[model samples]
Target chain A: MSEASVMTDELRKQIGVAGEPLVVEMEKGMLRKFVDAIGDPNPLWSDEEHAKKTKYGGITFPPGILAAIMMVGNRPPIEIPLPRGLDGGGEWEFFEPIRPGDTLTIECKIGDLVERQISMGKAIFIYHDTVWKNQKGQVVATSRTYGLKY
Target chain B: MAKQLYYEDVEVGIDIPTLVKHPTTQQLVKWAGASGDYYQIHYDKDFAIATGLDGIIVHGRLKIAFLVQMLTDWIGDEGKVKKLACQHRGMDLPAVDMKCKGKVTNKYVKDGEHCVECEIWTENPEGRKTAPGTATLVLPSRGK
Candidate 1:
């Protein structure tokens, strides 16, 4: 008996294909909620007065907020045959500060796929690349997230 | 908040201040709500155990948040995080002490930007690195 390959031809076709674009508005309430969940006491993310004195001149969301924002929009789902999935980690590059009232367009796509043997036996790693652009059409941030299917 | 860290002030191989976090089940719940990642393994212990985990595990993204906080706090308000990359190699249980630590690896001027690089990671109580990563920061130069 032999195990079937998790990376089928159909799955391989998804690589480099862009998904639907998602637009999200930066709201103070949502930013606060995200900062609160992280338990970070940075005044830049909470206190308007304190942030006003900083170079940012107003409250700014932390880079960590990307973790939450990336989850808000829907993307085309790539069905994998693996039973369990785990977050393998991610890489992010920031080019702008996210502030309240800024509308952002997020585009995501499957960057690549690879198969490897791990302690869990066999796993398929899917890399999702996401780009965030502000209303000005400036690229604010880009991230690559890895998901492990085992 | 700490004093601003300038590119001139950072020395290669020096350790940055560490940020320690104690993540409880309640915090995990808050994270699940905030992140929109209501994965049962992060909040429901029974479901997590059913999937072969010891119990509920801390969210990997939450640990990434901790590491980001550590870097931002070290860089101060004038600094900016340019890039961050990490790998989730191990799982952490709730209520455990997750220590975020980093050491400056290199510094240089690129495209007229003062850049500093560091090796960052979160360590379990037993001194094992659960999530190891690297970060690049742009700090204000004293000359400017």
Candidate 2:
């Protein structure tokens, strides 16, 4: 490995280390803003009248709302020596609908690390595994996010 | 939201309705604010160029959100998205047409829930699959 490689002992040590739990309350206004930004006109996400008639009986956010919640919530940050980082996409498994007023506690941990030689030179891929539970302690969703640092 | 898509209606090899998006810098700014990414590479052209990118690029998570919207719209109110996975293979520039498309890959009843699986992706204007992924959805049964 070159001296400039972003994969360091410190980053490797973070693998499998869990971060502090982040609690986020799903707010209707925030959900509206998120859906609006996506340009999604789904009434279930915004129109209270339409949402009240649905099975959820209230505004239930789209699955993508989880991304907003996770992105904005506070979590331990991995210090990569690299100057730039890019999102490598993610995987999500949803077990229940997230409705307005639901309090979700998200727990995250570094799952793994891999070093790859790319056209841009050496890069380190960090995998984070996160679990989302409701106030009732039921796992509403679990996700894995991939981040590339170079 | 044309009609409620029932489990019996979906079949392997069928294509889901496509959603086309024309993402602009304004939309990216809105997304940055709402998503709290605040990454200059997504909105600041000069910063993105300095970082070696062509220019400001679309947020990968925003594209993922588009894919999610397509799935949710197709499934309608009665259906639920169970699992989704995506990989950002290439960067997409602003003001480009990105089409979100999917095709059913599998259908089955597991654990009393009617499930459907699909191969989903966001295709850039060049017809390249920039963000390829898979999704699992639960659709209501017509028999029930």
Candidate 3:
């Protein structure tokens, strides 16, 4: 049927793979707001003195907060011409906590694309895997996020 | 010398205090700044709606982040969140009053660690469940 073929046509071709060594900076205000927005009152993310008493030794975001540092389409070899998209699912692995004022670089790889259609529209799933490392090149967290293009 | 909740302290039918979070476009944008997620679907409403979505949709990870924070705050640093999973059940429209809730479903001990499993969900003002999932955590011993 035409619909099935169109669905297949909508399949996203991996036009490109994002480059590695992508670095991102987190400002203090932004980190504070994110912690506040999530209502995570833990001193770990805000209080430098309190954080110093812990293993991390300074204010730091939660391990899961690494999900915030992945920048899609920000650099070379990025996916081209995506029309519609949605966050489908993701998997996370934590090695260490991310701290404020740390400039982190993400090592990234583009995964296979999946195609499908529904009442909403024809959708293409773009999958990306990334590893976050602190300025010291220590791996902090890794994640794979799936986004849909319709 | 931290405390851990026991399986005996929790009941199957008891409800955990619900948290309601209403994420606005500004908030999502701020999340973008903090998280480095530039997917236009989160910021560009016109383009987002053109895709047949009612409006811009919140990042699935952000929603999970909220859930994670809630569970972590409840369990504390001495505890560990072993695993959490969620299925995208509904759309979260921007600036809408959305509610997040969780309930204790199961409890047990493994490797001498007390653990609790909870059912979590987020809903819209219309009372429609958007994100539903399960979370597993290892709590410290209650006597510690």
Candidate 4:
């Protein structure tokens, strides 16, 4: 959440670093649930003994999970006045596998706005860059998302 | 661990195995909780309808994961998923069959590493693509 004034602050607060990077704990339970939700039946994501034999040394969430790591707490709404929003897609880069028990810092930087008209309506392709770093400060993953603000 | 996929063994235009996903409302709720995307449109039916959307829609990110799984599953143990990107062009509703499909578009030796690029996507039952994307992966060569 941003510590800012209500009105103009909404824009100001979100324009910058987009508030503090959320700290997320990749607990075992959460990873398991996420694995199930994705329908990934791989034992590397659920089986403890199996994961112990692998290079990751334990269960890990698929790299795609990093794209949404900012959801640990209540995320303040984006102030864009566009009525409907859709995901325009993103470039996600994974550096290291996200394992259970790892703590991550998620940083988001907005302001890559390209306003253009689409069939849906007047849409702005809002780009957001987010990086996830582990407690050791190693960058685990990075993502650039184009959110369609319409 | 699955057997490592060798780069030399793969060829361009080869279809990787398909992974079919059934996105349920329960899974969306779990994704919303774990991923921290509490968007009402993803899990709240009434809220989504009020917001001019059809009933609860599946999260785009979830579909992206399905695509990733399609690659990672075929790439196997020694293979590495280097880069991936996707665009959400359509909405995916719950209880529908979403097929994750992909094929190798190119193969090359980059910095002495055998690499393959694949075009991947998830299609709804009507056969319209919901999420289309690309992925680059490095696989071990048979000799190396």
What lDDT does each candidate get?
Answer: 0.89, 0.88, 0.68, 0.79
lDDT of 2 by residue, B108-141 (tens): 9999999999999999988999999999999999
Q: Candidate 3 at residue B40, lDDT? A: 77
Q: After superposing candidate 2, which stretches have Cα over 4 Å from the reference?
A: A1-9, A69-73
> DockQ for all models, in order?
0.74, 0.74, 0.37, 0.68
Ranking by TM-score: 1, 2, 4, 3
Tens-digit lDDT track of model 2 for A62-118 = 988776635424445788777767778889999988888889988888889999887
- The interface root-mean-square deviation of each model, in the order shown, is 1.3, 1.4, 3.2, 1.7
- In model 2, the Cα lDDT at residue A141 comes to 92
The interface root mean square deviation of candidate 1 comes to 1.3
For candidate 3, give the lDDT of residue A55: 57
* Best-to-worst ranking by lDDT: 1, 2, 4, 3
Candidate 4 chain B, poorest ten consecutive residues by summed lDDT:
B1-10
Query: CAPRI verdict on model 4?
Result: medium
Q: How would you encode candidate 1's per-residue C-alpha lDDT over B24-112 as one tens digit per residue?
A: 99999998888788889998889999999999999899998899999999999999999999999989999988999999999999999
Off by over 4 Å in 1: A1-4, A69-72
Using lDDT as the measure, which candidate wins?
Answer: 1
Model 4: how far residue A111 lies from native, Å = 4.9
Tens digit of lDDT per residue, candidate 4, span B59-133?
888888788888888987567788999998889899989999998999999899898999999999999988998
Model 4 sits at a Cα RMSD from the real structure of: 4.7
Candidate 1 — which pairs collide?
A: none
Worst 10 residues of 4 chain A by lDDT: A1-10
Estimate the TM-score of every prediction. 0.96, 0.94, 0.74, 0.87
